[model samples]
Target: MPETAVADTATGVPLKELAARHGLASSGRLLGPVEYARQLWGYRHFITAHAKAKTVSTLGTTNLGTLWQVLTPAINALVYYIIFGVIIGTGANTTNFVPYLCIGVFVFGFTQATVSQGVNSITGNLGLIRALHFPRASLPLSAALVEIRNFITAMGVLLIIVLITGEPVNLQWLLILPAMVLQAMFNMGMAMGGARLGSKMRDIKQLIPFIMRFWMYASAVLYPVTRFTDHLHGWKLHLVEANPMLVFVELYRHSLMENVTLAGSPRLLWTEAVIWAVVVCGAGFLYFWRGEKGYGRG
Candidate 1:
């Protein structure tokens, strides 16, 4: 019998002959495990490269650039301690308000960094985005990575404070790792969303600082949420209970404080956190992806 050949529909070439001539018999459309793995590896490499280049470029601008990440948060913590702890007399009620405020500010710093820096991630990288055709998500991811690096540095400062204050470190402290991961996931989503929104509406850039300030006051960073639950009733109480930052702060206090749990309502707060994480992340990713091509233009 003679050998049979299949014709290529688009080019009108014999498929088998083309395959034999070009040594491409096994190089069909990428629909299987090998192709998937190859693409995944390529994406991973691209993301890592983008993150590294961004980190270096961002930190190289100043002589004490990297140190400033740690130093800035430490200074902010001191300011908060002086105003809220020493001057305002809030610390007078708590046994160790220093560590309490330290953790609160440090965690909140992650959120603050995300909102403030994220607004400019797309605009700031307009040159690079227009010049390169890589994934737009990489920009926000790179920014988030830089923020996480700063968070870790601030965390080191927090640990030093914890030790100096004679606080005990235990296995529960490990819980913070997952909490931080969750927090980062939440921030990444928000950053991506913020980047997309800010790119479209420049007014959003101006509003972020005010929003963050209001968020700080509402999140129980300065005072415990419990202080409000005692005075409010019904819907107002529900509003306070539904704040995602309240849950996050409670989680931090629970992990750091000796015996603190979700003070008012554990179930309600956890549900809010889980819902916010899912909804914000999902919506943010979709919003960012939809506008991926537009980011490079303006």
Candidate 2:
């Protein structure tokens, strides 16, 4: 009888109760975690197809095409070799310094590309986000996939370069598979977090490059991780060794290069890498999901 008591006129039922009974929800309602993950799984095929399409189209406009993927990192390694390896003499005592540096650059580039693209995944696809009704996580995921594809191409070239630099194709090289899988997991987490931040704060997209550059330097992409251990000791040494990107780079180097010393013990490096991947991937997914309802809104 109250003025606020709205009902389904014909059925004489409260409107809210009727909607619930019919399994209806607000347009922007947040899904429960289980249901959300289920929906995401349903779109797995779509995600892969979308990723493949983007991978091909991303470099389609360029004359060099996908060659740019390998060339970009290859060229970066060359420059770093000139500055650090030659000019600074960081490579003075290191064996296969060219291959070591290339491994670092190419491996770090995978994370850099994924996170950088993830930062724009949502903001860059505003129109698509507004027009479509799909799991928003797909954007960052697809972006990560694009980089994964590029990284694979770049990796082939990397192995060739390593061999050209006189590193043997030994049993340890097989370890790159697990190392890359861990790195990919970590990169995906970073991408999702970047997507959420970029969606909410557009300015983050501009700052990500500088952040990634700093990360690259800290990851020891140009120099050996020993550079950190040589200067810092105790907790400082431990802290630098804990860097996930550095962990991944060292993992690849250990697998590919002979007689390379890691910043930390092998067990410690692997343990930290596994921890980083699990924690970041879980946390990033939850963080992005929590903001789902707010996406595409002012």
Candidate 3:
């Protein structure tokens, strides 16, 4: 009998009567702040569940699934040690280059895995993307989480190597905690950006491996960044000095092996590294977020 009443076409019931029966106002303000907060909280829970499910599925798919995460990096370190440390003698001059190489390789693996796997992550799961309605960014985030777990396991191996090789432990080792968090954030950002681009272009996926290989060489995983900086002068030296990966590798090496002071006057290189980390990560996240809806369609 009320003027606000409206009939439901399908059920032939009055809309206002139905709302009153259900204890909800049919024409209430659309998604006010309180409702919006509830929606966001639900989204957060869904994302967490999705991420956990993906991680567990990955581990379940293979017999040695998670262990391979640790094994792969350790095996890589051993191979490099044999070739560079024993046979080639490249690491001979540096004190405890074994741990140095191990840490670099271990950390680098995390970055490489996220970048390489993420490039194909969206495209590879195109079927699922079409069938399911979910956050596309979660694919890259899930992949990064898997790599992060692997990195943690590899780090444990690195600590054992450090102790076995008789490297001194100090408060500086705590610095690695922040360093790892920064690196993981940076890698996730890159993965998200790359995944979006790779999904559309497809050609971008092909180029990722070559890009990663070049990055590996540039990052000084096998040797020191000083090798490049010492030889080149002025702007040439500055270019190599500006590499962000080198900064991360150097920070890890300095903190874990050298136990050097992390705080001091910020050098130009350090300042550049900080800037790149922020810029790449911030811009990449925005770039990926903008393309979120597009991913579900294709």
Candidate 4:
């Protein structure tokens, strides 16, 4: 028998053996969580490029392009402020509510868009999933990344709005950074879980918008969470206060606005936010990864 051929390149792996080594797993193989994570890491560049491409392609056909990212949320914040803050008097006791509503709408929309897009990631990319031999998680991760980019752009406008509405820039505002990180993690988890769920039940895509709408209201995006706690008690009050989106909204509001109190204490909210981010992200990733083999099946 011929001696074992050595790989001639610096990586020391031949094109055939290399493929054979990596080809150890078939497409949609059920990888261990750690192995799945490593696989995803190896595809980081693809994830980033795909995410940026998706974000651009989404608005590329339009003249305004990325400006819409900033405008859409601004308009929503204004509409909510007008409808609930003015007509309904939801802003009755809240100070600096223009900025408050702005923060809530922008922050909540971040997670909301992630979940909505996540619900379609795998289904929308069925062609790519079936054709390409990459990690299935990339689709949802890319969607979450798109939302993260959009959120950053939207925040630029949000900060300007906050300043225009007379919220002072203080050390507390620095808290926005950590809160954003946590929320991003939370969004990633939601995206992962939604992708798995949506891929299985295509009808779920249709229902997500309504679910997010309900989530928005429950998050106190348009009104104060106090509305829930002022009368309700027991599990009801806890449920309202414990809503993850509400926690994120309150965190953003606390960091951005002055004289506004959170639904829960700052300490409680921070602790809960961390837990939500870790638990949801970890669970969502594993859940989505576990469904890898099933994503592209007929």
Candidate 5:
């Protein structure tokens, strides 16, 4: 039997050879890291639009609309204040307990929501993935962006609370900008990692809430970070201080509140913040990239 080669009709060249000559790749093949990044960057507009759409639709059904973005965390902070600050008397020794807890609650809540949404980013968008050829990373990045947009509104409420609680407006408040940037980077990384895991294991989404709850306590959201100093020492103390969420929460406190002292020096906290942001974000991106080809496969 004679085999007939498949050829591009217009060029009259064999299709496989024509594709090779044009530097084409298999549709399902994984792209090189550099190429993948470039492709993802090229889709930035789509990502931003997707994020904005999701952010708007998130609270569209509610009476308050986007106001719930600020209220949700504000209410969480109020509840924690009643339970931990008043009933438990955890805030008795700390100054400016109200703003302190608000910063912790809002910041941790942002990260928790970012990661939780990231976990569903892929599974939630299977239809889009199957129908489109855009970078899959866009889904997770858009998930992070949605939270970032929500967090900005929440921050406005947080600053108002800080002012009402007697924290003076100072130049250090500007530090919140860089602190937020670092936290956003760290969060993007967490979301990418979660997206990858979620694509493979549906159960991971169900577990995220429990994990984030534990992370909230570990992050010192309802209590003073200084408590770690009283109970632990050496590597134990150092390890707890290195928790990325705690580092971010303390960074917010250091910037906004003058009365609160942190578990570590400002220099150490900033260093850890930069390190965690780079390390986690870089590692998570690579981890997710490695699974790129498998993302939409059933």
Candidate 6:
């Protein structure tokens, strides 16, 4: 019964090997991708439940409650409309600018919230991290889920705005289903990635708001994509063209508004959407898993 002895009486399997099989032992090393996924799946209920509870508590203090979810983005759209659409005239040249602006705002709102919340996911839930034995990723995954819930609710308002602006409901509107699925996958990845980084560097959380603001502007939330292309050239323009957020925004605008035209071909944008979704989500899941043991301690 030496501490280092490998022998176990009952199974005659080496104690170390038995521990490894059960995942009770390791090289004090990163978990493999498959193993990490298994762990996450085991806690799926915790993730969903936590996300739902957080959503409720988030609105608990407000008199209007969940109504704020839709209102906040609507109010944001109005402010941007006044400044970018009316004052600076960024939306003037665009056809059906209100619908165009609404789609952009609503869609970008999800991405912006996903990343910002992800950055705080781990740090914001330090008490849970310190106290719980479950996967740390549940924190960020739940954060993304909360935003997803908000996005779904806000989308109803977006559809209304598009209809009020005279967008015909067509087969194209169905495209929102796939577009949202892809974007959600991407946000999950981005959120998990941000969660891992934020846990280690708390200062990064403070900078996320400014970063998301710049990202919203760059994603053409309140302005036309033409604003970026008008003065830019070479790969610089292509960089803007291929931005993941821009791809998502264009997808939303195209699906919801007949008057709007996408900057890239639909096929190409769909391909890019699939690529970014898989790449970000797969990579983010793996990255978060790799740091499995370090979260609570660090």
TM-score of 2: 0.92
Stretches of candidate 1 exceeding 4 Å from the true structure: 1-41, 264-271
Task: Give the local distance difference test score of model 4.
Answer: 0.90
lDDT for position 259 in model 2: 89
Task: For candidate 4, write residues 1-298 as lDDT tens digits.
Answer: 8877768487887656876877664443478999989989999999999998997889999999999999999999989988999999998988877888888899988988999999999989989987988999999999999999999999999999999888889999899999999999999999999999998898998898899999898898887777887878999899789889999999999898887878989999999999999999999999998888888889
Kindly list the per-residue Cα lDDT of model 6 for residues 1-298, writing each as its tens digit. 6666677898888887888788685556666788778878999999999998998898988899999999999998888888888888887789999988888988998988999999899888888887767778889999999999999999999999899888889999999999999999999999999999998998998898898888888887888888777888999988888889999999988888885767688898999999999999999998888887788674
Q: Name the better of 3 and 5 by TM-score.
A: 5
Stretches of model 4 off by over 4 angstroms after superposition: 1-29
Residues 1-298 of candidate 2 have per-residue lDDT tens digits of 6588789889999988998999998786899877887988899888899888886788888998888988998898889889999999887878778998899989999999999999998888888888989999988888998898889888999999999988889899898999988988898899999999999898988898899999999998888777886799998888887889999898898899988978777788889989999999878888889998777877
TM-score of each: 0.82, 0.92, 0.80, 0.91, 0.93, 0.93
**Candidate scoring better on lDDT of 1 and 2:** 2
**lDDT (C-alpha) at residue 113 in model 4:** 90
**Could you tell me the TM-score of candidate 1?**
0.82
- Kindly indicate the candidate among 4 and 5 with the higher lDDT: 5
Off by over 4 Å in 6: 1-5, 9-13, 17-29
lDDT of 5 by residue, 1-298 (tens): 9999999889899998988998997887888888999999999999999998897787888888988988899999999999999999888889989999999999999999999999999999998998988889999999999999999999999999999999999899999999999999999999999999999999999999999999999999999877888899999988888899999999999999996889788999999999999999998899999998888888
- Residues 1-298, candidate 1, lDDT per residue (tens digit)? 9977779999989987888888564532323434443543567767677767776787889899788878887888899889988788665656677777787788888888877878788888888887875666777766777788788887887778877886788887776776777778788889889989888888888898889889888877776555676688889877876776766777676666674535455455556667777787667777787675577673
lDDT of 3 at 175: 75
Clashing pairs in 3: none
lDDT of 3 by residue, 59-112 (tens): 779988778767888999999889877898777667778888888888888899
Each candidate's number of clashing pairs is 0, 0, 0, 0, 0, 0
lDDT of 2 at 23: 92
Which candidate do you rate higher for TM-score, 1 or 4?
4
Kindly report which residue pairs in candidate 6 clash with one another.
none
Task: Score each candidate by Cα lDDT.
Answer: 0.75, 0.88, 0.75, 0.90, 0.93, 0.88
